[model samples]
Target chain A: MPSRSLWVPFELGRPLGVPDDADFQIGVLKSLLGLFNRKSGPVIEDYPIESPVTAETDAAWSCTIPLPPLPDTTTPAEALKQALLQEVGSLAPWHAESMRRMGRTSFGLSGLTPESMPEVAAFLADVASGENPEPLSGLSEPLPIAIRYMADDAKAYYMEAANEQPGSDSPGGTRMWTWIYHETRMGQVFYDLRDRLASEYADRMAANGGERPPGPPPINPISARFAVRPEPTAP
Target chain B: MVRLKDLPKEYAEGLLNLPIPDYGPAPWTDAPDLKDARVAIISTAGIHRASDEKFAGGAADYRLIPGDLDFAELTMSHVSVNFDRSGFQQDPNLVFPLERLRELEASGEIGSVARWHYSFMGATDPSRMDETAPRVAKLLKEDGVNAVILIPV
Candidate 1:
């Protein structure tokens, strides 16, 4: 319990309502400061803007980047790798533009540069193919953890680049995530990884006499822990 | 904007079922006027400089962000993927609001901005912060921060 708590109805990621809207943000700030004047015990104020506009509520937004269609000439795993690399390559300029325009980015959680998106995508491709390749260097966490951050970095890179498209406004994370999971080959890779992780966990449990093991599990299943939404469609 | 009930059932249930710690009666005190208070932002977004250590799963530590540090240098490393990062990717002010705070300070809506801010990753057990909260409070007091606005992601 706080002496002055402001309960807002915004989404999980956006506590200040709208992005890039300074006036609205300032309004929220002032309302919070107004709580200091109550002259009472604990005060939990409901910020009057009950239904604030947010990225998730931006119905007019969509991804407009021209991602090339996936090539069908190679093995599925190889195709996934090539397709993701091409997508990353195609979005490079727009990501650069986004960086220049915003002067900041939310990438680099995996301790890799934006320039390393391709490497990260390739590694994910390997994961999607059920290969336990060596984890990328300079990662502070174990492979399972590093994979989650790398996947997030890859998503950020793509989304940030897509955000720089000229015509339509940027969609919120919900729409973008749906588009990524259902529409892109990268999404296919993620589905494959999720399935592989699930299979591996089952195998471990079977090896343990069909009983749960003690302590932390061998892997931090992204699907279980992170709860990636928009359940993967049938492969 | 999405309300608690609007979220998916499992996630919504998880949030609703989180254990709330009762720290006795909420501490009360008279606060200085908004025009005279020095404010600091205390975020649970796992934000830090890009080069700083990333928050491991359920790590019970916090990061210090100097007020003078470049906003561009800040990035979030929260372990949860349930929340949206696209908003933060486009405009960090959505989460950190450092720019908005600066604007308020410049316009005299607040007396001043604290010299330091802090962030601790959310989803970790709040009881784990008991030992560290006092140390952070001491630092905020040292920085003359009379008011703090806690933000969560």
Candidate 2:
């Protein structure tokens, strides 16, 4: 078993679901719920791809997704659509509004109209909302590039931390709650389709279903390292 | 785990004098006389614009991607953070902490600022950084940066 808690499904930085998208945001929480069920029982979930490789002409964007090979299920086009659907299924209608609000509060923004777009949202629509559900293992080409990038980081950081200094031992190795928070604080990026990035988090308890203390809404911070660098290591 | 007061007093003094073009104090202490340290930043702002690609895989373990768009304006669209601008105009901590790093470089706390930095949208898988960090390491190496700070957005 990997010696760490797994948390992926919120915003790009804080993978616990953004506060705004109340309904769909729960997907992040649900995902966490799923994580708890993995009792050394190989828990492997697949993510659908978002964005079309052919549409990806810009080298910068192209580099980010690293378009993968066509899935065996169908044509590359079908694979692309399947990828987009899963993303859309996990999203909320207010995704844009929430993102805008988030951008305003955290990133800075101009407005939510058509003209002020920083980047084209449609391109993502194709990829994120597509429905080709396949294990990340099947992806090759562009996407594997991105996935391998993240997996390698997680593995290395843990190894590096082990070498640096031993961490505090909460009951079961790293507490699920603390581990989740620590990883997010360490700068864990969630797997796709926007609305899941929320910083407010609490260790999931059998009684508390995992909700942070409520109140005080001043742009919740998610692991300061992400706020500035990677969240301070739990060592 | 550095206490606030314990932090170099120069940093606070500098933060106060920012937007003035010349912040007098150093950015970080504890850092060895950083003549050429490499610095990198990680953003949880989930910032990749519609222009950038979202994360891939079961980060069901890490929440990320297929972000919605707010076509309204581009004030801070350049950045992907979800911060409020009420306090950030004169100081732009929202995007990447360019101003802050610049202040450090100006004060000589850092030998020199790396020309380029990394911007991870923050919601994807942190486990998969093996793929991301190297890209940054490569970029930094190409630019001749020695150490990386990794400013979180």
Candidate 3:
């Protein structure tokens, strides 16, 4: 079977929409479900369009997978990674076309190597934390604009710094911020954020590098990889 | 002082008099009828379970948690949700309001809840988004869900 079926869009770990706000979050969840309503093979469509830059609206997206017997989380996760990397590479050409439509000028595939995953992850940390750091060098065009590294601990802590200040005294913003801060406090986000850097051995490199995994199988899950802090009692 | 672009006739008559909340979506339409339909949620603020092994502060996942927003709860937020995983927790208000939804579901205002709902962290990326999003759709299809309520938390 396929190493992985589909992927979800949000952050790396957080799968659902939000932790609490069931209504709007569920709306997003339903959007994901809308994907499977397709009667045929896997179909892709965009929805809930409120803006022109719809895809990058930073809104989360999801898909569904029927649960019969999932491979052990570890095996599937590993296989899924290979699948994801293949998907990433597969879309490169399409992304090039998209860049052309978006008025982008250049793309540097070499810059997206494992060596670049940490930098991209750092840039994501910066962007999520309101840093808006510069893009990785050599990327003349903004195709795909993502990097992947192996799973580790330190990277985990920084990746979770994705917090915004709470407003209106509502608990939503504060609760998520608390979660990320808690991750940072636990130092796990940092570790996962740079996992590939930790395991950059020569053997780690896939022969295809820019292609899908071999043997139609071979995946690993970064299981329970996120580090959570103890919740404090609210007075 | 009304300019052509800021004409009042084109806007609401009581626009100036309308009291807007400082945060959250401004309600224009009546509340959605949660009858005989599944209500799914999508929070932009990254959310994830601390228990998931392949967690990251990016890539939103839409795993549903049952009975989180009941009335008996004091302030049941998805605090345990992992932001390091979804990053959508950047706006927790978007992610952990299950306690609130559970409250609504209990009042009988909402019809039978779906067996599953969804979540995913928020981040920026343009290419291959559809590829990343299919997992949520697969879950909903399997759960037999119909309606979804997207929360930009």
Q: Pick by lDDT: which candidate is best?
A: 1
Model 1 stretches with alpha carbons more than 4 Å out: A50-57, A137-142, A212-235
In candidate 1, what are the lDDT values of residues B27-107, reduced to their tens digit?
668899999999998989888888888886688889999887787898888876665777787777778888888888998
* TM-score of chain A considered alone, across all candidate predictions: 0.84, 0.19, 0.23
lDDT of 2 by residue, A1-235 (tens): 2211333321122232222233333333233223433445334443222212111221222011122232456554445444333322222223334344434322221112222111212223232334323433322233323223222222222222221222321111112212322333122222222212232223323235654445322222232222333343322
**Which runs in model 3 stand beyond 4 Å of their true positions?**
A1-235, B1-33, B54-94
Candidate order by decreasing lDDT? 1, 3, 2
Ranking by DockQ: 1, 3, 2
lDDT of 1 at B19: 94
For TM-score, the strongest prediction is 1
Per-residue lDDT of candidate 3, residues A1-235 (tens digit): 0011123343332344344445655555445434433434434444332212123332332111111222334553333333333333433344444334433211222234333444443454443333335666764234222333222222222222222111222122223333334322122223333343323322344556744434322211122322233453221
- Computed on alpha carbons, the lDDT of every model, listed in order, comes to 0.78, 0.32, 0.36
Kept native contacts, fraction for each prediction: 0.69, 0.02, 0.13
In candidate 1 chain A, what residue range of length 10 has the lowest lDDT sum?
Answer: A218-227
Error of 2 at A79 (Å): 44
For DockQ, candidate 1 versus 3, the one ahead is: 1
In model 2, where do residues sit more than 4 Å from their true spots?
A1-235, B1-32, B48-91
